[model samples]
Target: MSTAGTMLVIGATGTTGSRTTARLAAAGHRVKAASRRAAPVAGAEPVAFDWHDPATHAAALDGVDRVYLIPPLGDSDPAATMLPFLRKARDAGVHRAVLLSSSAIPEGGPAVGAVHQALPGLFGQWAVLRPSWFMQNFTGAHAHARSIRDEGIIRTATGSGRVAFVDAEDIAAVAVRALTDEQAPNTDLVLTGPEALSHDDIAALITEVTGRPVAHHHLSYEQMRDRLAQQLSAEFAAMLAGMDRAIAEGAEDRVTETVQRLTGRPPGTFRALLEREMPVLPSDPAVR
Candidate 1:
């Protein structure tokens, strides 16, 4: 609350993590940005870190009282890799922790769930961010974005399911508040954009914004799983497709005011986000 000590941000180069670190640093907060490579983050100290390697933990935690927890990517169960460092952070007197989780994976559900369950007992102050599907998934290096850019198609197993896709910047803003606020929310926050729309709606929006045709191709769960398995393990691929199946069942079709309540502003809409980010899509014919 008083904002006295350095804040350690794991996954500092990642989507929300980068934004969080930059925001914290711009606010004049001392920050340690930890990633696998030691690269400078604007207004913050950068350090090399890896979840699997415990040896890189302490240096990052040194002199830090708060942390931003971004779980290991591509790991089905990340708790096994993350808990040990968290335990050490607790012992080292880190008092506040903000974990970046997903709306699809509820607290105590699957990947980062175990870490979410263990947070309350480990630290005096903590918040778990369960953000809906990120809006950036359609514009950034995400698989969907590549498909949209090259093939003019967005593919998923979520049939007609709608999602209130949130923005990474909004999530970072909330995480900054959780780390620095005089009174932490002290509970898991479910963050979303102001509206819910299906993938078809997103494709339509993109088409309108970019003046290029875009389509959402619905795939069977098994088809999606098989497609994903070409790049990922079978188990992880099935898990990802299963999340889409749950969305198709109407799991992620809700909006929340948590972003507004936390950041004193409304969350960014999918259309607005597309207008802002779509220009960055490759204009080069070779990219298509």
Candidate 2:
């Protein structure tokens, strides 16, 4: 957890990764931004690193004592690839490790959960960030954003269930603290925004802020799964649909103060994020 050593940020071009990299670099912390293409990131050195490619692991680990891990996306079982790399990282002298997981998944539950379960054993200074659904899903290139832009509709199987959609910036701020703080969190943190909102509420906010008409289209679990299967594996699609069903059952209904407690500031709200990132709809366009 030495501040002198470099921090490696995997998925540097991604939602929270990019922001985490920026925050670390801006704070004068040494950072290595890791992406599959070794794409350049501002304020940090960029290196090519893929979870599936063990060959790229050594170079990325060089001079790196801390790591911000974004598990390989779309893989139902990330522990299969992640555990091996983690062991290699430990052998390479890395100290602190912070993993990005989801609120929907818990330690030893599924997907990144297995990695979460093994983190404390791998590194003394380790934290698992389980953030709720991201607010960026409506402003960025996510399916909701794309659908909102092209069709003015938000489709989901999540009925009236509300989620405290957190902002990536807030998540990054907490991550920077976890990485550089004298003491690591050393425990799993569930991060969420200030308020829990449903899809209909989100669509209304977007419409209110952007002056554009947007509607939420509710779909059955089967319909959502089938629709998502067109773009994702059948298993992944089913899992996603199942998450929506879970949401419908009020699983993601509560809010937490993790962001505020860690970052010394209250987490931003969804409406605030929308106003800042998208005050107006795109004339023609495009999270974990």
Candidate 3:
């Protein structure tokens, strides 16, 4: 499916949004990169946008016909803030929307799920990308990766249950399709990587790749909650621990071909991701 029009990408400098913005621009579509700060993406118009502040919404939606939605972070229920801008976008002639959702959160579940439920009625063309835990969580600017770099340990409450961690690049590829395709899939797409592996397996792979010892520590739900509560609200902390509990219960163990089905290419594997983001060796030979 092929259609061309200006597309707005929220969370413009973020992991998936940056990739989607570059992809759309490279494909010859006009793009509006929206963020709370100026995110001047090459070949795209940059606009300051914040979901909590309705005043920033209109300028971002000015000439866009399609949008890639990344709901406000840290807010348990962003629907209270997001719904109004979405309505405004529709009234301003935006016809399609692609939302970044999670595989753990089903439609009508907590967080972005509320907006996922409301999208269908708001636009004739829309797609909800429900992606699995990101492979980048093990290598990028995530807490798990930070611990790995600093202490050589990956900590989580997920005991032995496996997760099919999809690559953020694959998610972005799917989003491009959802935004530019002539017809939206018009349903929630459950996206996953090619295989499922436990956190221990991920640690082992990192050790193998970096030639440095890495370990996975399994924490109880309560322990994990307490740890996260030090940095986040009690409610949000509990919700995160609960998701880990669900993972331990075998909720995120399956793989899906939705990425390949949409993009005509297999999603990258965890090892491939690791290879691409090779761990940096210390400058001093003694540290290495």
Question: Please, what is the whole-model Cα lDDT of each candidate in the order they appear?
Answer: 0.90, 0.92, 0.91
The prediction achieving the highest lDDT against the true structure is 2
Residue 89 Cα positional deviation in candidate 1, in Å, after optimal superposition: 0.6
Give the CA lDDT, 0 to 100, for residue 36 in model 3.
96
Would you estimate the TM-scores of all the predictions? Answer: 0.96, 0.96, 0.96
Cα lDDT tens digits for candidate 2, 1-288: 344589999999999999999989888998999999999999999999999989999999998999999999999899999999999999999989999999999899888989999999999999999999999999998999998877889999999999999999999999998899999899999999999999999999998898778889999999999999999999999999999999999999999989988888999988889889986854333210
* Number of backbone-clashing residue pairs for each candidate, in the order shown: 0, 0, 0
Off by over 4 Å in 2: 1-4, 282-288
Model 3: pairs clashing at backbone N, Cα or C within 3 Å: none
Worst 10 residues of 1 by lDDT: 279-288
Report the Cα RMSD per candidate.
2.0, 3.0, 1.9
Error of 3 at 276 (Å): 0.5
**Residue 160 Cα positional deviation in candidate 2, in Å, after optimal superposition:** 0.6
